[model samples]
Target: MMNKHTQVIRIIMIATLQLFALRNTFSQATAQRPNIIYMMSDDHAYQAISAYGYGLNQTPNIDKLAEQGVLFKRAYVTNSICGPSRAVMLTGKFSHVNGFTDNHSTFDGNQQTVAKLLHNSGYTTAVIGKWHLVSDPQGFDYWNVHPGQGDYYNPDFIENGIRKRVEGYSTNLVTDFAIKWLDQRDKSKPFFLIYQQKAPHRNWMPEPKYYHLFDSVQFPVPANFFDDYSTRTSAAREQEMEIARHMTDTYDLKLAFDLPKESQRGLNSLWTSIYNRLTPEEKQKWEEAYKPSNDAFYKAHLSGKELAIWKYQRYMKDYMRCVQSVDDNVGRLMDYLKANGLDKNTIIIYTSDQGFFLGEHGWFDKRWMYEESFRTPLIVKWPGVTNKKVVTESMVQNVDFAETILEMAGLPIPTDMQGKSFVPLLKGKQKGNVHDALYYHFYENQEHKVAKHIGIRTDRYKLICFYEKNEWELYDLQKDKSEMHNVYNDPAYGKVQAEMKQKLLELKKQYKDPVPEIIP
Candidate 1:
C-alpha cells in the first residue's frame, strides 16, 4: 500500500523528466538554423551612406556589412513608395497582387506573410518599430509597432496589442525593446527579427545627442538643384515638392513657429504638432540647438537661389543627424550579437524601405521610376558563407526578400509568392546577371503630382510609358545617365525602345498585372 502523496510525487517527477528531454531535443534541432536580423530604415537614400562613395556623410555601422560581406549595387524596389514597398516585400508579390499599391491602400491581414511561413518552419518571429501597414501584424510571435507614419521624438509604440508611450528618442526606444525581446526569446528555437527604423524621414528630427553632429560641415549643393524641367512632362513641371517653392519656411527650414493659428497654413501646423509632442526637457534642448541658426537665417535675408541653397543645407544637416543615430544604434545591436556569441550563427541584412531623393532633380519625395528613387541600398552579411567585401551588380528587387529569407533558412517558399529566390546569387554560383530585365509600375497619381506610369529597365537602356497622357520617354544609360533629355523620338533609339516595350508587356502578363488600355 503506497501513500497518495508519494504516488503523486512520482508522476510529477516523470513529467518533469519528459519536459527536459523535449527541451533538449528542440535545442539540438534549432542549433542548426541560422538566426536572422533584418534592419530597415525609412527614406534613407544610398547617396547619404558613405559606403556607396556618394560623399555626403559617413555611416560606419551600416558600412560594416559592405566591409565584411557583400554590397548590392543594382538593388531596386517593385514600387518606390514607403507602405507599398514594405507590403510587396512582406508578401513577396507585386503591389497589384497584394492590393497595397500606395499609401492609401490597406494591407490584407488575413493573407499569408513571410513571417507566417517562417513561423511554420519552427522559427520564433518578432517585428519591432515602424510598421506603416494599417493592420496589426499577424503570425508574428511578438510585435511592437509605431502607429501611422510615426513621430520621430518621444513617440508612442503599440506593443502586443497594447499602446504605451516610451520616454526617449524613437531610435533608442525601438532598439531597447528589440534587444529586450531577444533577451526574452525562446533559446530552444531559431529567431527572426525585423528592426525597422523611423529616422531620416520627412521633416527630419534628430536626437538631442546628435543635434550638433553636422554643424561644422557645409554640404555641397547638387549640380542640378536648379533643374528647369523644360523638356520634361507635365507631371515633372507641376510637382509641389521642389525645395525652392514647395518647402515652406516654418515646416522645413524651422525659421519661425510663433505665427497665430488663424494665419498659419496647412503645412505650418506640422512644426507646432511636432514641437508639442516633446517633453519639457526635449523641447528645451531642441530650441537650444536651432535657435541660433534660425536667428542668423532670418537676419541674413537670403532670397532666390541663395535662399534655396540655404534651405537645402539646413535640410541635409538635420537629415544626416538623424542618420547618425541610426548608425550608432546599428553598432550597438552588432556589438550585442558579438558579445552573446550569436554573431557567428546569424545572418545580418541592412536596407531601406525604398530610395529617396537628396536634392536630386530638385525634388524631395520618391515615386517616379527615376534612378534616385528606383535604386535602394542593399547590404547582406552571412558570417561564414558570403565572400568578404564583395560588390555585386545583380539586378535584385525588394519583392525577392521573402523568398530569399526562406531559401537561406532552408524553408520552402509558398507558391502564392511571386518572387524568385536569389540564394544562388549569394552562394556565388551564378556568375553573370540572373535577370535580363526589371519591370516597374506606380499607381498613385494625386500625391506630389507624380503621374501613374509603367516602365522597363534592361542592361543598357530604360523605357517609360506615361499611358494616361499617351507619352513616352527613353534613356540610354551609356550616354545620358542624368536622364535629362527624353530620347523617345530620337531615331537612334527607335529599335531599342520597341524591344523594351515588347518585353515590358510580356512581363506584365507573366506577373499577372493588368495592362492599361491607353498604353502606347
Candidate 2:
C-alpha cells in the first residue's frame, strides 16, 4: 500500500527509538551502583579511636564516620597478623584456604578475589598503598603499592609494576594518588578503590608537624600494665614482646644520644638505617624537637620501674602522633569526595588490619588472641542504606568483607567463598549477630615467640589450644574482661569448657581447617 521510500523511513525511525531506550536503561543501572572506597590503616588499635570511648587519642574524622553510619563494637579478625588478615579480607576465607597463612608466603594472585569478581562484573578496581603479600596485585585495573612495611618518610611505591621513590610522607602520598585516580577514572563505570595507609605501625614515626604534639600531656597507663603472667600457660610468660625488656631506647623511644652497646632485637641498626634516609633539613628539625627531652632523661639517670614508665610515656606519645596524621589525611579524602558531589553516591568503609597493644599487659605488638590484639575497629557509612548513628554489637570478622562488598555491588557471590554476607543485617532485615562463632589461627611463632595457637571466640566464652605445647586455656569473658585468669582447670567451669571444646571442633570442621587432633 505504501511506497518503498516511506517504508524505509518508518523502519529507521523505529530503530532509533529502540537504541535510545536501551541507552537510557543502561544509564539508570549505572546510577544505581554505588562507588566504594575502602580505607585501612596498619596496626590501629580500637582503644586509640575516640569513638571507642577509651579516650587514648581523638580521631575526630574517623568518629564522624561512626556518627553518620554504623559502629561495630565486636568486629574481629580471622588472624591477628597482617598478611593473613588481609588475605582473609580479600578472599572471604581463612588463611589456610587462601594459601597465605603468614607474612613470609606469597599470595597466589591468580585465585579468585573480590576485586577480580568486581572487575569482571564491569566495575573499575584500583588498590593504592601497603600490599605486603609479596606478590604483584592481580584483578586490578591500576595498582600503586608499598614494597614492604613502608617507610614513614620519602617512601617507595611500585606503580603499575615499576618501582619508584616518591618524595613526601607516606600517608599524604597514598591519599594524593588515590584522589588522582578518582579524578581520572571513566565516568561511565562505577569504581572500587582501596586507600590503605602505613602509619601508626611499629617503630612509630610522626611527621615534622606532629613531633611535639603531645609534649605536655601524659597518657594514663592501663590498669594491668605490669602483668606477671602468673596464672596463664607458659606461652604468656615466654613471649618476647614485653615493653620493659624488649623496647630499646634509640629504636623505640627515639633517643639518639643514649645508644645501647647491644641492641635489643637488633633494632638499633634498623633504626639507624631508617633515620639515615632523612634529609639534612629533616634531621635538624627532628633534633630540635628531641634534644630537650633527651637532656632531661640523661640528667635523671632513672632505672628499674621508673625507667620503664618513662619508656611507656615516650612510646604512647609517638604512636598517638602517628595516629593524628592518619586522621588528618582521612579528613582530606572526605573533603575531596564532598567537593566532587560523590558523597551522595559513595560508600565508605574505615578499619585497620589488626589492633595493637599500648602498654596493655606490658606488651607492645600483636599476635596473642588477647582482646586488645584480636578486636579491630570497623565503621561503615552508606548514605541511603544505613540508619544514622547506629551502634550494634553484632559480631563480624574480617572474613566477611569480600562477600559483603560483592553483595553491595549487586554481584552474585561465588559458591566457594566461606564468608556470610551481612547485607541483611545492615538493612535491618536480620537481627542479632551475623556469626555464631568465629575461628582464628596464628602460624608464625618465630618473631615474637608467641606459640602457634588456634582459638575460637563465641559471644560469651573463648577457648584456646596451644597445640604444639599440648596446652589449653579457657576464659569466661563476662567475668574476666582482661583475660587475666585462665579457668581451664577450674571445676566450676567443667561444663562450659566441654561445650566450648566441642564448638571449637565443629568450627574447625566447618571452615575445613586440617588441624591436628588434640589429646584431651
Candidate 3:
C-alpha cells in the first residue's frame, strides 16, 4: 500500500533499529566485563563425558553446558600432573617457564596470575575448592581451599589463610562456600570465580548420597585392561598404577585395618575420616551398598585376568559415581547463576587440570603422553557469544586459559605468558593463528613410576621422548588412533618422524623447556 520511496524508507528504518539494538547490546557488554566461572574438575577424562560420545557414563548436567556453548574436541594440558597443571593455568605459561614442574615443587604465590590481573582491573576474584599448588593463593580477594588434596567428607578448608572445618561432603561444601561468596561479592562490579572440584581424584571417593549409584550396573572392561606392556619401554611396564595391581584395599578401597601409612597406600586421614564422619544412617547405607560386594571380592581371591576384570568393574563404578556428583554439583553452580540472573552476563568453562586414565592401556593415573592422559575435556558457555552449541577441533592448552580470560576482559596478555588466547576461535571470528600442535612435559620421578617425558602432538602425528630412559615413541594418530603401535622406526614414515622431532625442538625452545633432554 506504500509508495516505492516510503517502502525503501521503512526498510532502512527497520535495519537501522536492529543495528542500534545490536550496538546497545554490545555497549552494555563492553561496559561490564563478563563474570567468569572456571570449573576445573580433578582427573575428569573426556572418554567419560557423554558430550564426547565415549558414553562411558551419562553426565546430563555437564552435557547441558556443552549443548549451550562451545565444546572443544582437542583440548589438552601443558603438563598432565595436577599441581603443575594448575600452576600453568594460573600463570598462562608452561610448567618449565612457570617453575612448577611437578607436584613436588612449590607454586610461588607472589608471581603474576590471571587472578591478579583480573583483580587489578576492577573484577572481584575468588578461588574456591582444590588449590593443590601448595601456595597460599594470592590475588584472590577471598580464597577457601582444601589443604593438600582435601578430604571427601567433613573436610577442613583454609579460607583467607584461616583453616576451618566444614561438616559436609567436599563437593557440596565447595558449592555452599562459593555461593556464600557470590552472595557477598560486590554486585556493582563483575567477578571471576574458580570453582575447582576435588571429586573423583584418588581413592574414587563418592558422596554418601551417591553410594549405590552403580551397584547393579555392569561396566565393560577396557580392551587393553590386560596390557602386557609388550614392545614398549620400561616406563610403560614399570608404572605403578593399575586397577588390578596398584589399587589398594586398605587405602584406596576403604577397608579399614589400621595399617602403616606406606603399607596402607597413599593418604589415609582423609579417606579414613570419610567413614569416621558418616552418620549412623549414612554408615549403614554405605555398608549396605559396599558390604556384599567387598565380602564377595575378599572371599573370591580374584587373581589373574579374572581379578583384573573384577577390579575394573569396581574401579569403573566408583569412579563413575564420583563423576556423577561433580556433574550434579556443577549443575548446582550453573543453576545458581541462572537463578541469580548472572548466566547471561557470565562465561562458564568446565574442564580438568588434566585427563585421567579410565582403564586405558592398563593405566590409572595421568602423566604419560598417551591420548587418554594427554587430552582434557573442555566445554565453555559464553553467553551472548557462543550461546549455541559449537565444537572446535583447534588445540587448546590449560596454559591458554589465563590469557583467554584476560583477552575476554579486553586486557593485554602479559609478555611473559607463553600461551596465545583462543578467544577468537571461541567467537568463530575465523581469525588468528592459534596452534597447529601442542607440547607436553612431565617431570615426576616416583609417584606413579611413570617416565619423565616430553612430547608433542600434531594434527595426526605424535612424537614423544622418554629422555629418562632414552626411549622414543611415535604414533600415527590417523592410522593407529589407539597409539598401541609405536612407529618411530618405521622406514615408511621416517620423514614424518624427523619433521615432528623438529617441531618438538622448536616448541621446547619457544617455551623455554630444557632442550638438552630431547637429544637421544
Candidate 4:
C-alpha cells in the first residue's frame, strides 16, 4: 500500500530503533558487571609483603588491599616458575594441559584463555606489561608486552605486535601504558585489564631514585642461611642456586670494582651486557650507589660465612629496593583509579606470577616445591562485594584465577577451564579451604638445577616426588613449617606417608597428569 520511498524510510527507522534498544540493554548489563584490574608482579614472594607479617619490607599500597578486602594465605602456583605459572593463570589449567610447562616453551595462543573468554563475552580486555609467553599475545584487544624477560632499564615492548624500545624504567613504563589504556578504553563496556610489573625479578634493578633506598637497613638473614643439605634429597644439594657459591659478584651482587680476572669469564659478560643497557644518567646513579659497597668489599677480605652474609645483604637490599619501586607504582595505579571514580565499581586483584626464594633455604631463585617458592601473594579488593578486611586461610592457586575473574564478571566459566570459581568463598557462602589438596609440577630442569618434580600439599602435610631419581620426600608442615626435616623415612609418619602417596596418585589422576616413571 506504501510507496517505495516510504517503505525504505520505515525499514531504516525500525533497524535504528532495534540497534538503540540492543545498545541500551548491553550498557545496563555492563554497568552491573564489575570491572577487573588483575595486577601481577614477577617473582614476588609472600615473605616480602608486609601484609603477610614477614616484615621484610613495607608495601603500604599492597597492604591497603589486605586492609580493605581479602588477603589469601595459601595462594600457591600450579608450577612455581614465571611463564608456566602465567600460562596456568590464563587457562585455569595445569602446565601439561596448557602446553607451557616451562620458560623455554612458547605459549599456544590458539587455545582458550581468560583474555579471549572475556573479550568474546563483550568485555574490553587488555594485557599490559610482562608477557613472557614467547609468542604474540592473542585474544587481548590491546597488548603491550615485554619482548622476553624484559630488562629493568630502557626496556623494549611489543605494542599490538609493533616492537619499540621505550626509554624509562620497566616498571614505571608498564604502569604508564596501563593508565593510558584505561583512559582511552571503551567506557560503555566492562573492562578487564592485566596490569603486570617486571620488578623484583632476577638481576634486581630499581628505579634510580630508589637505588639506595634500603642502604641503611640491614635485613636479618634467614635462620637457615647456611643450610647443609644433609637430610634432604640429592636434588637439594645439587642445586646451583646457592647464594654463597652460585651468586656471581659481577652479575648478582654488582661488585665489579675488584674481582679476580678469571672470575670475569662466565656470568660477567652477561652482567657487562646488562650494565651497558643503562643510559649515562642511569649508569652514574648505579655507579654512585654501588661504589662505596664495592670499595668496602675490596678492602675487607671477607670470606666463608662473612662473605656469604655480605652477598646476602647486597642481594636483599637490591631486591627490596626493586620491590619498593613496584609498591610505589601500585600506589600510583590505585590513585589513578580513585581519581577517575573507577574505584567504586572496579575489582583489583594483586598477585605474582609465582613466589621467589628470598634467601629461604639458602637459595635465591624459585622452582622448588618448597613453601617460599610455591606460595604467592594474593590480595583482592572487590568493591560492593568485600565489605571488611578478611584474612582467609583458604587454599587457592593461580590455576583458579581465570574462573574467579569470569565468575566475578557474571560470565559463565567455560567447561574446558579446569579451575573452580572461588566466588562462593568471596561471597562468604563457603568456608575453609576450597581445595582439599593442591597439586604442583615443575618441569624445568635447566635453570638453577632444581630437579624436575611433582608434589602435593594438603592442609598440614606435603609430599614431594623427585620421580626422575626415584626419591620421595614428606614434610609435616604443622611440625616443621620451615621444611628443615624430611620425615618420609620416619617410622612415626608411615601412615601419613601411605595416605599422602594414595592421595597424590588420586590427584595425579584427577588433574589428568601422566605419572612419571620412577626407576625403582
Q: What Cα-based lDDT does every candidate model obtain? A: 0.86, 0.90, 0.86, 0.90
TM-score of each: 0.94, 0.96, 0.91, 0.96
Candidate 3 segments exceeding 4 Å error: 1-31, 255-274, 277-282, 431-433
Better of 1 and 3 by lDDT: 1
Error of 1 at 397 (Å): 0.2
> Which window of ten consecutive residues has the lowest lDDT sum in model 1?
511-520
**How many angstroms is residue 38 displaced in model 3 relative to the true structure, after the best TM-score fit?**
0.5
> How do the candidates rank by TM-score, highest first?
2, 4, 1, 3
- Per-residue C-alpha lDDT of model 4 across residues 356-454, encoded as one tens digit per residue: 888878889899989999999999989988878999999998899999999998888888888889989988899999899999999989979989999
Candidate 3: lDDT of 205? 68
What range of 10 consecutive residues in model 4 has the weakest lDDT sum? Answer: 257-266
Cα lDDT for residue 157, candidate 2: 97
Worst 10 contiguous positions by lDDT, candidate 2: 257-266
- Candidate 1 structure quality by residue, lDDT tens digits, 1-520: 7699999999999999999999888778778889999899999999988899988899999898788877888888888998999898889999999999989988998998888888887999999999999989997999999998888877999999999877788998889998999999987789999999998888888888888988999888778889998776776787778888888777777777567888566878877887788878777888889999999988999999998888888889989999999999999999999999999988998899888888888878788888999989999999888758989888888889999999889888889888887788888887656567888999888768888888888878888888788788888887877778888878987888788888888988888888575454
Model 1 residue 48 lDDT? Answer: 82
Ranking by lDDT: 4, 2, 1, 3
- Name the runs in model 4 displaced over 4 angstroms: 1-19, 257-265, 518-520
Residue 375 in candidate 4 has what lDDT? 92
Evaluate model 3: give its TM-score. Answer: 0.91
